[model samples]
Target: MLLAVVLASVVFSAHAQSVPKPKEFYFDEDKTTARPIVVVEGEGEAQVQALVRERDRGRRQLEATAQLAHIAFSDGRTDLGGQLYQQALAQTDAKGTLGRAVRWNYAWDLFRAGQVEPALTRWVEVASAYGSPSWAPPTLALALWRLDRKQEAVAWFGAAVRTEPAVWIDARNFASQLPDWKQEDRDTLAEVLGAWQANPPTWP
Candidate 1:
């Protein structure tokens, strides 16, 4: 009996060890999940610096500049992020996916820095141009709410819900932060929240 119990414990321990840990996802300032940054193994900061050097030498300039911009934004260096984004945009096709991504990240940096107006403008651009990503509308709605545009904010909030049901929890949480929302708007948000709670969207 003692030997059997010990074997059972070992088996349990082995099974637990075999289970992989879930990957942690990070959100940007607007609570939008950030894209994963890929770094070369064993190179670390040296690899990023080498990429920047390669950009300066005009080899893979667009990719290098964008990656450095993302790193700067992730590190909270908005000034460097802005400059790098501009450099990348100059070399990228403004109507393409990469351009939209750079613009979105730059807008997020602006939002983090409290440049709400410009951030709103850029977010509007991103929504109009991309229109598919799940993050943009809710983020834009939060910006509008911050700027005291409650009506427009509520409209965008609904738009976000319709566009991405998976974001209902985040949108509801964000709506709760708007202290000056009218009672009617509050009621509307409450209804949406209750519905979402009852029928939660499946994770992608």
Candidate 2:
């Protein structure tokens, strides 16, 4: 009887150990992908980790890919920039915000490559994206101005000013980059610069 009681206890213990318990660890649900993510320790840590991951991944996603392409453009690697932009655009759908932004990036890439006409066309599309911030119009206008489309540039600038006066600050900064900016341009830029000096952006 003692041996039988010991055997029964042993079997019960083994059974309990074999069964799986319900998960107790808390994780955030990534609704977009339905993946479980452990909470990051802090925002700074998360951002740093994300940037590290981005570099390690070689910008596998559309947004990162576009950013990489922009960097390539800045470095004067026209062929590589175009290739990356095309790859990014191909991965995104028409309705995707990433797609629209990549399109704009590609356009800027073209402009940097000295393909001005195609860049203007791409800028027009960017200007039409739903819920695009008011800051975009002035930038687009500046691009048009660079192409010497004076009337259209002026109209777009007016739209930007009416929609978001803050964009004038951006226009001023862009103008400052020109090698041969005239006195008139400098005067206009100064006015915008003064405004920005008085009220700077809270966020970079």
Candidate 3:
């Protein structure tokens, strides 16, 4: 019964996109996820510089720049963010895991800025790549939701959850950004969660 409820309730919204995992910095040894990074708001450029100066190389560095781009977009500096995202893509040829992650971030940024067409175009490129990370499908679902393709969004969510049951935690965390993700969404998502909570997918 709980399983059915979790599936039926699979609540998530497209707006609650994930933050790219920070590649250039680490939490202080004593800190847990409870502690937040507290750089002053609007100093995103400085943060980017700090991350760049940390000597990231190859895919690592590209991901760092992508993280910087994410910070910039979150700070309302879309032009600067776009430039960094482009630079990251250039650095990696946009074909590997980190590269795909960067593309995902770039697509989400573009979608948030209401540049839906370009965002969707970029999303296609990310989806086609080999070894795209776990983040890709949910990010795609979020984009589809924002574009008002609710049914497609739901299907993508199902795929994401099916492929990565651990991703339900992500879905729970990102619940705010999915389609129909109101209180009602929470109720529905509980169904999906209930179903998968005990039987997360494993490699065949």
Instruction: Return the TM-score for each candidate structure.
Output: 0.57, 0.51, 0.50
Model 2 worst lDDT run, 10 consecutive residues: 17-26
Worst 10 residues of 1 by lDDT: 17-26
Off by over 4 Å in 2: 1-60, 165-204
lDDT tens readout by residue for model 3, 1-204 = 998777655643334333222121121221111122222333546766666664264335655676777787878899999998888788765566566656766776787677865786787676555443344455555555656555555555555565544545454554653442345435544544444444543322
Backbone clash count, each prediction separately: 0, 0, 19
TM-score of 3: 0.50
Query: lDDT by residue for model 2 over 1-204, one digit each (tens)?
Result: 999999987985564211111111212221222111222223444644653466457434555566666666767888887887788668876445556667766775686677766776665564444444443444455555666554445554554444445534464454544333345544544444444356542321
Choose 1 or 3, whichever is better by lDDT. 1
Q: What's the distance in Å from true for residue 106, model 2?
A: 2.4
lDDT of 1 by residue, 1-204 (tens): 999999987985564311111111212233222242232323458878787676778546776777787677767787898888788778766557666666666676676677767777666665555424456545555666666555455555555566544545553454445443445445555554545456544423
RMSD of 1: 18.7
Candidate 1 TM-score to native? 0.57
Error of 3 at 45 (Å): 6.4
| Prediction 2 TM-score vs. true | 0.51
Alpha carbon deviation, residue 204, candidate 2 (Å): 34
Q: Please report, in order, the local distance difference test score of every candidate based on alpha carbons.
A: 0.58, 0.52, 0.56
